[model samples]
Target: MSGPSQEVVAPKAPQRIVILGATSAIAEAAARLWAANGARIILAGRNEARLNKIAADLKARGASEAIDWPLDFVTADAGAELGKMVDRLGGLDLLLLAYGISGDQGELERNPAAAAKVIATNFSSAAAWSLAAAAVLEKQRRGTLLVIGSVAGDRGRRSNFIYGATKGGLAHLVEGIAHKLAPLGARAVIIKPGFVETPMTAGMANNGPLWAKPDAIAPIIVRAGEKGGPVVYAPTFWRGIMLIVRNLPAAVFDRLNI
Candidate 1:
């Protein structure tokens, strides 16, 4: 009989990693860390200049290979493009989806087009890319899929519910996909970060103990992809914070401002 001390080991560092939102602060932090560890990275995003700069930095930081591809996820053919990337890399060991816009909540409420853009960027495009990537990983029967979500997704708050709704939708989709992929030896991880100091939140008053820097959260995201559970909260305390929010009774929750 096997001993109680037996433990399953995590897979090796992924050789080829596809970062969908390569220019995002958190993603770029993760890319640099992975590059330093010798991962081959394909940085895909809309900003060609930013992509090139980050790719060069990754190479300088010791990435085995660093390349970039220009992509506007809202209009691009996700399935075809991801297929080409996987083929170009020979095989994919990890795929990170870290792009999203924190659409103005008040503006979204007043503008239908603004709301649609948020939905497209946060949910529709991500779903499309996830399906495309899932197909490839399923066939290969290996790889890790890491998605950056938000704690707001745990429940709807009036402050950012528009953005929260999109993230909530994504978390639900990936949860179902995780089960489906498990049987095939593939893993899907959802990283729910609290208040991070990124460009997306630059306009907001992000100072104080609650806000985290990109570099602080980056390692947690990478480790979750490398070896961890399906859902993770960067900095970890956010998990407890959200648990309280989620379990609040409807009447009590509605009376207070979050």
Candidate 2:
């Protein structure tokens, strides 16, 4: 005696969207979704060939327009590069920073240079782009700047403490920016995903039920970006997972091998 469930339609996607690390799997997935929704997209990444391919694919999928701008994000010109992206897009409605690296914990423990590289890529470079994007969006008086963080950032783990630490830094940075952007009518949000099965994590054992695919997680990113919240956990379940992890006592948490 139950009626069929009604389908809920999503709001219109951002018109002008800029993805800083467009070559990443999750970012590409989000790009395709946005393209399908008729969003204009600007793809910025290090690999010109990959960026071009994604741009073409987005066009084929229905984007109003799709274009690529190649740049290495870990340079002095990173902020300038972000400025160029905003300019190229004509104006920015949504900006996503999705570049990151999960470094080897043992290697980092033994090498200061390795630790520096991880910090530079996952934290410093991201911060530069976020700041640069914030300046433009704030002046424009509207836009959402979204950064892809990780659940590892909620609590540092022995397995990937360096990566966790960098993400933790990014989480705090976005939190502060989110507060600041409130008055400017712009928004900055941090999205933390847990155990996403991407090329970056291909070496790990990802057979568990908690693991998420790029396609599965992309919609969550779009939803959170559209809603303009301070923080979001992809898959929704990670919110509960991180809540328990964050609340566990040090004595209990330190003993675990997670």
Candidate 3:
């Protein structure tokens, strides 16, 4: 009776995701979006109470499963902890490194210890975790490692050069990892967002049009994980903005107060 047979396609399977620095506003927002897709997620952070609360919220939001793993990002043995998490999850589809600190530029300039802490948290610790996750993804020959970077990293400015430097370093690191994973069918993505309205930036003057909410940036992060990336600028406009800044002459750039 039928003239021709139609092909039937199966629905895509749910993703397995891990969010380090799960308590951060941006990470939480992204996790929420993933949860709605029936993803299985793990929330890893130093604050157990907050992680538990977030895990419960994600579950309520329709995540297939949500597990909280308390972890101190700075001092933890990244390789060992990541291996354990991979085992617990049975495998990994995506790992998001979202932990970072934007220390007071003035304080960082004055106190070496303060600057050190910022460097350690934003660059050293983040890089360690990234490498661990990269290794896992490489071994599996699949998955994505997504890291949150900042637009400030596009060019070093007087206002937040320390933080900017760390982000710039992270961008380069992710680029290398991306290259390494390319042959293996794995991916590493770095998301650079500008002036996000998160708890971290609450104290800063962020009411301007350029400032964006964490929720607004979360979708871009999720898309990058699902698709592919080495570098992504949230809102997409920042790429143009940064291109201009990065190409500015040193003499002209030094005169302006950014």
> Given candidate 2, what's the lDDT at residue 133?
83
lDDT of each: 0.92, 0.90, 0.92
TM-score of each: 0.96, 0.93, 0.94
Q: In model 3, what lDDT does residue 21 have?
A: 94
RMSD to native for every prediction? 1.8, 4.7, 3.3
Over 4 Å off, model 3: 1-14
Tens-digit lDDT string for candidate 2 (73-118): 8985766777777777789999999998887899999999999999
Tens-digit per-residue lDDT, 1-258, candidate 1: 966896778668888999999999999999999999899999999999999999999999999999999999989999899989998899999999999998778999999999999999999999999888888889999998999999989999989999999999999888777888999999888899999999999998987899999999999988888788688998899999999999999999999787
Q: What lDDT would candidate 1 get against the real structure? A: 0.92
The sequence of per-residue lDDT tens digits that candidate 3 reaches over residues 126-224 is: 999999999999999999999999998888999999999999999999999999999998899999999899989979998788989989999899888
Compare candidates 2 and 3 on TM-score and give the better one.
3
